[model samples]
Target: MTSHPTVGHVHLRVADLDRAIAFYRDILGFDVTQQSATAAFLGAGGYHHHIGLNTWDSLNASPPPAGHTGLYHSAFLYPDRASLGTVLCRVAAAGITLDGAADHGVSEAVYLRDPDGNGVELYRDKPQAEWPRNPDGKLAMINARLDVQAIMDEAP
Candidate 1:
């Protein structure tokens, strides 16, 4: 059997190149390393790009209608719970509403929508040993409300 591929980068067709850059760069803290008239590349920690935004066909396009099968959500994993709390506070201060926040047994996640209505998940994974497992030794992920205050208390 062939090995599955790791995710390289996520490329999106955006309605406006500069606007998308601002959301990813100014808001999400991605660094813009490359740009053309139509394509832009963004990265964090200066290791090339983790995301690419292009306005090829979506130059003035609106978001896909609800119930579409594309892009359920893209998760951005934070380094720690404090970072997660910081992001949560930033999102709150920006007046962006969360779709949900959950403690998923293995991770704590906060869900929101990007400027283009794309779902985004910001999360931090719990240690492997702390994750719950079923009787069969498979992961037993449960979605319950996350204690936001407790997490923020961990923030420096």
Candidate 2:
């Protein structure tokens, strides 16, 4: 047997390419490394692009109806709580309304919608050495209230 595997970029069809680019680049700090009049690609850590945005198909299209089995959300993982705070602050400064925030036992996250109502999640993982686990050593993940104020305090 031969083995080679990898997960590549995630492409999204958004209603407005520029708006999506602004949300991902300006608010989320993803570098817009490539773009055309109708398409844009963004990334972090010098990779080609982690996200590709284009309006080839969904231009002016309404968001997917709720209760559907499509993408729930796409999460951008930050390296640390401080960096997550940076994103939270950016979201605040951008006047974006937050839909929800939570501590998922192993990670802290903030949720909000882009201009086209697509869900975006910004999160930070807790150190694995300190993650909560069961007696059998399995992760004990659950949705819990995240300390938004405390996370903000970590900023600057």
Clash tally, candidates in order:
0, 0
Candidate 1 local lDDT, 29-147, one digit each (tens): 68999999999999888769988999898998999999978998888888899988877777777788889889999999988988888888889999999999999999999999898
TM-score of each: 0.91, 0.92
Minimum summed lDDT over a 10-residue window in model 2 is located at 5-14
Clashing pairs in 2: none
Please give the distance, in angstroms, between residue 58's alpha carbon in candidate 1 and its true position after superposition: 0.5
Q: Estimate every model's Cα lDDT from 0 to 1.
A: 0.87, 0.88
- How many clashes show up in model 2? 0
Clashing residue pairs, backbone N/CA/C < 3 A, model 1: none
Q: How close is candidate 1 to the true structure, as a TM-score?
A: 0.91
Q: Evaluate model 2: give its lDDT.
A: 0.88
